[model samples]
Target: MGGLSPAKRLYQTIIHQYSRTINCNSSNHLAQRLIQEPISRIKTTLDSETVNKSGDENLEFSWDSLLTCVHHHSPPKAQLVLEWRLEKLLKEKEKNENLYSDLIHLCGKIHDPQTAMRVFTSMESNHGGKPSSNVLDALISAHLSSNNMVTALSIFETMQNSDDYKPTAHTYNLFISAFANLGNSKAMLAWYSAKIASGFLADLDAYGALILGSVKLKRFEDAEKFYGEMLEARIKPNAVVLHSMLVGFCEQKDLVKIRGFLKGVLEHKWRIDGYMAEKLIGFYCELKLVEEMEWVLVALTETNHNQDLDTVSQIHNGLIRFYAKLDRLDDMEYSVGRMLKQGASFRSHKDVENVLCSYFRAGAYDRLDVFLEFIKDSHELARSSYELLVAGYRRAGLCEKVDLVIKDLETQRKE
Candidate 1:
């Protein structure tokens, strides 16, 4: 076993275990013993056995839990155990229902999906155990998580062709969400329409997901149409639906549309959270609507002085960038000063710091000076401040400051 490959070792271990457990002359006694022990005890005993054998603390016997654990566990070691056990089962070719049920459960438990797929495939190839829709569902889920939508789709389509294997709305919903995330509105809509035609009532979440996908695809009209149909179907739009609509408007850069959406949200008496406000502010910034951006920023600050710093930092950097591009030194100074006064958060964001560093490097030196003055001794600038300070002095033609920074940098390097 020591000289064998990990896969071979795993195979041997699984074979040895299966032989010891299943190949007894007292098969009835083993069954009685299993029945005597509660399922919980059986599970705990199985887990303990695996842990002791593998000496891997994270190895779990439950299929789903084991998937996550074995993923981060040693792959070769886990794969060996899985392959060996599956191979031994295949070699047995027994009609023992208990053994088959255990193998099916183990098929689900195997962490490496490729290994699971192989075992399932092998069951179809050599073993007489039938592949169930649950097996297909597992494969689809694993592939989708890996962003292998094509493989998921193939499994789905294959499952659909089997007259005995009718997919439920849950199945279609899974595919819809997957396609929507990939920005494939056409496929999402197709599945959505198919669900409708099949006389399945679309859940609010499903409609919301499809509408959101439409928004991402820039099909605002389609999204609006869907919303109308949703209302006609007597389904109330949830906060998620409204947020997706707002996002759609933002994507279109249609401030008027977004205003209308926001007005509707207000009419519905929904409170704005940081995410929605951030989206609205981001929309204005994207369109370079500086006045609108300022208004939104001030409104947010007044409404909640302790609002999220990440959003404020985003709004601040957007203005800094706008000013830098337009060469509006006065506006830049005003924005930086306002930020300092408001105690804006997100001065700590990596992108914000990079933008500030760029501003200094590009001889927006006055703006850089203001930012450094404001951020100094602040927690935000504790990191990379030395580098920016060095860059700043180099740009300002301060040879003494540059030399001191360079010497300090070298000393830190050695340490």
Candidate 2:
């Protein structure tokens, strides 16, 4: 233990702490076991590796679990499971440069540049491992993720010094994306120029950066110009490119471009993310094109782009809200049933309130009661939602219905 490095000591400390607490809390036993089981397995595997000392580079040490900590969590915000395990990971005398690359990539993703650097430096110290192109890219990205441009570029310059790890188109895209996000068109173009001078034409990702930047800056014409050049390069526009184009057209209210873009989206079957679905649905709704909005849902199903449950729910909820705003009860009510049939339901309380309010405004009190009953079985009808209904009905002079809402709230409390 005295011979162990700080990273190794920390790893052992964590394992020891978890082991000691494994049986201490009876109420949280199941939860604690679920959390600690994998960690215990990791410790056991490491102990075995130490005993065997085979020094196999590819440790096969739960890549999925390691990478899972990266998603939807920033390092500063999360406990950073990756940071906790990754530095210790490199203490192993193995040359898993690829594994290290993935670790550093996750470090970049979580915006933990310090952990990224630790893992990178550990590569040479532990196993005399040389950095790969992927390693350098991830290292660069780790710095960029923290907006540490000086460090990122210094790393990029180091790449220029290494013949084995020079900048590729993807490396250029990293800088381009970082600058584009900063809205620094000058720096973005400079990187693009450098990419071209390096004898690498702009790839899909680089063009994506350019288009996305242009769209963000509201430079529709520049975005169109970049899109045209992308086409001239004989590169098929990806979902990101198409999404940017659609957003530009939507902003400009250029229906001709929108129609062409949507038609292309349908024909080419591009992936529509949740944001895209909401934007497209809201765009058409702004134009009062209800049929077009429904067609978007149909198009999603036909194109098999509705695989994400969240995105599907987003589309359905957007439509429900829009239909309520239009006071189209028949269509809105049918959509509610259809959303359930698709295994998506009213996930947002505000949307449910909008639906109830629509029914109330239309004087469909019987239908309102039916709708409440229909959803009550599945939806967690919040007390605040009941309060809202009572308030709405009371203002509309529906005394009896207000009493019913109060009763429902009381019943919910009892339940």
Candidate 1: residue pairs that collide:
10-80, 11-84, 63-109
Models 1 onward score TM values of: 0.54, 0.69
Which regions of candidate 2 are displaced past 4 Å? 1-90, 110-115, 228-239, 285-313, 326-345, 367-415
The local lDDT score (0 to 100) that residue 13 gets in candidate 1 is 39
Q: After superposition, how far is residue 130 of candidate 2 from its true place, in Å?
A: 3.0
lDDT, candidate 1, equals 0.61
Candidate 1 residue spans exceeding 4 A from truth: 1-136, 139-166, 175-190, 197-199, 227-247, 262-286, 302-308, 324-330, 337-343, 346-371, 380-415
Residues 279-325 of candidate 2 have per-residue lDDT tens digits of 88789878888777777777666676535777778888888999899
- Which ten residues in a row are the worst by lDDT in model 2? 22-31
Residue 240 alpha-carbon offset, candidate 1, angstroms: 9.0
Relative to the true structure, candidate 1 has a C-alpha RMSD (angstroms) of: 13.1
Which candidate has the top score in TM-score?
2
